[model samples]
Target chain A: MPKYLLIMRGTDESNAAMMAGIDEMIATTRQFIDEMVKAGVLLAAEGLDDPRQGVVVDFSAETPVVTDGPYGETKELFGGFFMLDVASKQEAVEWAKRVPVARGAKIEIRRVPGSDEVPQA
Target chain B: MGTVDVEAVWRIESARIVAALTRFTGDFCLAEDAAQEAVAEALVSWPVTAPVNPGGWLMATARRRAIDAIRRSVALRDRYPLLTADTPPASEPDPDRIDDDLLALMFISCHPVLSPESRVALTLRVVGGLSSEEIARALLVSVPTVQARITRGKKTIAAARIPFELPVADERRERVGGVLTVLYVIFTEGSTATSGDRLVRPGVAYEAIRLARTLAALLPDEPEVHGLLALCELTAARFPARTGPDGSPVLLEDQDRRLWDVSAVRRGLAALARASTRGLGPYGLQAMIAATHAAASSVETTDWERIVVLYEALGRVAPSPVVDLNRAVAVAMATGPERALAIVDELTVSGRLAGSHLVPTVRGELLARLGRRPEARAELELAARLCTNRRERSVLLQKAAGLG
Candidate 1:
């Protein structure tokens, strides 16, 4: 089976809205996770720390340059991701569509190549 | 079965058996050891009493051995209820799920969590059915090192709780790239020794080719897999003419093209066609460059301009200092030495390739073309000193001497 990653992105307004109802959000996400787990498709799921707490290590120069805090542009922030071992990209999309998210949130689905997909001797 | 037949069967089926056992036992290291024990038993008994289905027999034996090990282990006592010594009547693993097991083995062996060297060693051991000593000789590492890498690789996968199953579709693409990179690393080291007396280890290169052909056969739909296979095949075709009979390095321009392997070149071109149909990836682009060289009657007639364009595209997708240096060499052929030298000088100032001999070697050739004999000789001498291969060092020294 191939793997797909569901990248959940949220705008500042949507993130604030979700955080405001944190208890309800956690319950809703847990219920969703439980569904996937019961289906035996979910491999891993993780949510990110606040964007402001992150750092970027730029390697454009001779020495790596480390910068602190949120990225320069903050139109959309990566909120979390789910890795699912599904049969195909379509199936992954179906799973992503069921994710609980507020308005202005987006889930981008990407196919992960499996060992069977890799060429070998 | 004859000894040779037994060896061949073991080589082909070892990975499948180990993978199946791993899935059953939920322990990678134990599964591998059980599989090894089965192969050892096969070597001892197969010649004496050949089985109708060697793969099935091996799988049954391995599965039985796994149960025995689990049953004996104090740590595994809690899982004894889950274990079974019932070797199925059929020798084969469940037909429907065997392919998945093999695929899982590939991913586990080439897991990105392990170091690249560890990946190569472990993959060769578990996937390719090679012994530690064979792997040691192939990669020019000691036997203990090969063993250690394999051991650590298995432990790492187990400790990290890496699943013994194929990844989801989204991660499979990245996983494929990771596996290809491991194969490429092995092939590259085989083709050009990074720090060895000899310029090449033909055995390792051939081993890599074998592994690549297996990959291509199994995953015919993956374009980059074919791309990597094409690259390795075409590059290896030139091996026969790459060195002199006395073991001195033969520069490409001076090597006898007639000695190149025609059959390998044909296979490479066929693989390249497959890659092109799906749109060329980075390895495909590199294979195209090799194809250009292979198709040319001589170095002067090779399409340097096309090579430069491919390199530019390659840079956009997979930018690296080595690619830039290679592009500069192609540029020298397409344009002039002065233009190429400027590019090389820029790379020099960037200091990305400060320790590599390739920079000085290319600079020396460009300087020679520009009639700067003194500077060319000096650069060639420096390259000679930096070179690790005795054969290549001699060739570099010869170039420096000819400048006088």
Candidate 2:
């Protein structure tokens, strides 16, 4: 079995729509999580807090520049992710397709490679 | 004898204590209540001064509780004396032999009078020594639901006057089968959702294994008993590789075989050997089928011929559509898709599996293998539509799409 991290993200328009109907969205999302839990597939799931409450540190210069509050651009900003152990990338795609996201929002799935997959010295 | 020690004692001896209490009091509910009270007392007192004979201590204390409860009941005054026996702690029956009283307790808990749910709850409660809360969590039901099932089951037993004694000679085998079915149901419930609506509860399956081990020990002469134990062990051995963290099922052929539990496999095979000693019963046949898979490196390497024969025998004894459908799968693997297609077509004509997704799923696969792409796709689409499980439905749709 392989592990997949399903990252949830949305464009500005989609984010605004989610904010407008947060309760219904949350309810559906929770129901989705519950289904996974019942199926015994859910490993971890957590929604990120507002990106505005986050900070960015640019380390390009000798001294890092730290800034707080919202990013200059919210173009499909990362939201939250669910980590799951699934059979294959296809199964992960099915799960991603089932996510209760707004029309413009999309789930990006990345496979977490096994430690054993790496060549040992 | 701290709480840990008390817990250990209770875990190991609670069932026997409850059984003896039931035998003494002739009441299931009362026996359970008294046993719980005794455990509470042990929790309080065992930490200070541990008893030399822990099981006897618990049994004696529980027996006392049952007696006290009866003494307090005015209407039960006349029957009180019969409940109180003069057996000393040193005189407790030999612990090595299988206690008929404990076997009777299992029969009562899994009695045909109770619904399957009630039987599961009662079996875990009295035979496995699980608390109502634990049973609730393990079965994924509310505590109230487990309690209600247990209460209703006990009341029905009392009202029906279901005896505390074991069944007579002729019906004993059937009765034992009932008990095995309860444990099998529990294992399947814990194993996965494929069998029915139940979600996975790892604890429940392990508990069933424990109970089956207990039952196997108690019925050493009965090959089917060992057979069931083997079936549970072997099936559970695959649990490690069966599903993903998010509960997505890993198809057996695609599962990482290296992840399978070896020790469980060893134990299962041993039990299967014992089961074969008396000729394969229904459970033994199933165990043999599981054992075949267990010994295989891959589906390609599996002994499909032996499996087909085993399924044929199983169909004779268990005669279910599911068994026949499974046999068709083996037939395909052992021979070719054409023979397997014939089996599926016969089943479809019979309409024995009208609404199930399984028949069409296999039918579509067979058709696809035979290069009938359009019909295969249609069958797969129908399977997807009929399927209620989101995960399986997704797989079916994916398979259908692949045909394009």
List, for all models, the DockQ compared with the true complex.
0.01, 0.01
**Candidate 2 lDDT, B178-275, residue by residue in tens:** 99999998888787655333235556787788788778767788899899989988888888777666666678878888877776788789989999
Query: In candidate 1, what are the lDDT values of residues B1-404, reduced to their tens digit?
Result: 13335555655566767877887788888999998898889878977887866777888888889889988998877766776645442444354476567667878889989988889998888877777877898888899998889888888987898888887999999998988988898898889987677887766776667667666755779999899989998998888788777777787888788878776788799989998897899999999999999999788989899999999999888999999999999999999899999999999899999878889999999999999999999999999898887788888999999999
**Over the stretch A1-121, how does candidate 1's per-residue lDDT look in tens digits?**
2568999999999999889988999998997785454333565799999998999898989999999987767767888999975534655765676788988899988776532234333
Candidate 1 yields a Cα-based lDDT of 0.81
Candidate 2, residue B46: lDDT: 77
Q: Would candidate 2 be rated incorrect, acceptable, medium or high by CAPRI criteria?
A: incorrect
Those runs of model 2 whose alpha carbons end farther than 4 Å from true positions after fitting are: A1-121, B5-8, B40-57, B84-91, B96-98, B194-200, B385-390
